[model samples]
Target: MNKNIVITGTSRGIGFELARLFADQGHQVIALSRNADPIRALDHPNLHPFATDLTNEQSLKEVTQQIKAQFEHIDILVHNAGALVNKPFEELTQADFQKVYQVNVFSVAQLTQLLLPAIPKGGHVVSISSMGGIQGSMKFPGLAAYSSSKGAIITLSELLAEEYKEQQIAFNVLALGAVQTEMLEEAFPGYQAPTTALQMAEYIYNFALTGQQYYNGKVLQVSSSTP
Candidate 1:
């Protein structure tokens, strides 16, 4: 069955690949991004690109309103947009933390709340986190803020799962390892990861499509030992 889907940060990287994945599979994709040109350039009939800054409450509200008015139900909601600031823990300022939280945590929670009504029973919500958020055996330096924000995403999903259990809305987080994306490059600076954004997108797409049938409120860590 063709399902209505909403994905954030679809202008590039994993989000862009996820949008393409769903559109190719014949699902209706409402792709959200700060810049919509790349999404529009895909030119997939099943893909609809909407540009909005998720950090702005009013802007997010307007986008949600448009979505609510246009679509009767949303089968999958992927909160893939995030912000990252890599700096020493002492070098991080309050403003930096706020900015990271605004995109990585606050916007996701707010958008999920607004779109809850549009998600019918058996709907799925998946948020992308990082393995930095996971309790990795090896700690990563200069990622305190980013890791903390990603960790919050997992907890939020867990609580939402319990809170909305009756509705059968499955909330899950993918605590991804290092994937080859611009975000990864920004954080690590030239270091390459074994996984690519397209590969991660494939895993995410499958999980979002059938995850509810198997799991809920789970934070699954995806990683590869290959350096």
Candidate 2:
């Protein structure tokens, strides 16, 4: 069966790859992002692109309403928009922390809540977290804000899964390692990325299709070493 999937941050990175994969597989994909021009160029028969600034509550609400009106129910929801601010703790200002939290945590929670009614029973919600959220790596110096926000995402997904267990809504967090995306390049300019976006996207799509109850409320870490 072709599922109706809604993905955020589809303008690039893992989100774009996932959107392409789902559409190619004959699923209906509604992609929301601040920059939709690239996604619009995809113009796939199964792809629908919506320009949305996730940080804007009003815009998000309107976008969700449109999605509900068009699909009635969403089979899968992928929250993939996030920000990375790497700097010394002293260099990080309150604005930096607020900006990261707004996009990574606050907006995500709000959008999920707004769309909860449209996510049908047995649907799945996937939040893209990071290995930084699971465990602290070597002292990165200036990743406190980014790591803290992702930690909130991990906790939020777990709490949502438990709260909506009766509704058959599975909430899972993907704590991914380095992937070859613009974000990675921006974070570590000269460093080589460890994984391709397509590889990560393929794995996530397959996982979503598995209907595996065991994944519910779980945080799965995907690393370059993982099979």
Q: Pick by TM-score: which candidate is best?
A: 1
lDDT of 2 by residue, 88-147 (tens): 898999999999999999998999999899888889999998887885543355788998
Give the per-residue Cα lDDT of candidate 1 at 50. Answer: 96
Q: Which 10-residue window in model 1 sums to the lowest lDDT?
A: 131-140
Model 2 lDDT, residue 54, Cα:
90
Compared with the true structure, what per-residue lDDT tens digits does model 1 show for residues 104-182?
9999999999999999999999999887777543557888899999888999999999999999999999988889999
Candidate 2 stretches greater than 4 Å from native: 136-139, 225-227
Error of 2 at 128 (Å): 0.2
lDDT (CA) for every model shown? 0.92, 0.88
lDDT of 2: 0.88
How big is the positional error of residue 26 in model 2, measured in Å on the Cα after superposition? 0.5
List the pairs of residues colliding in candidate 2. 87-142
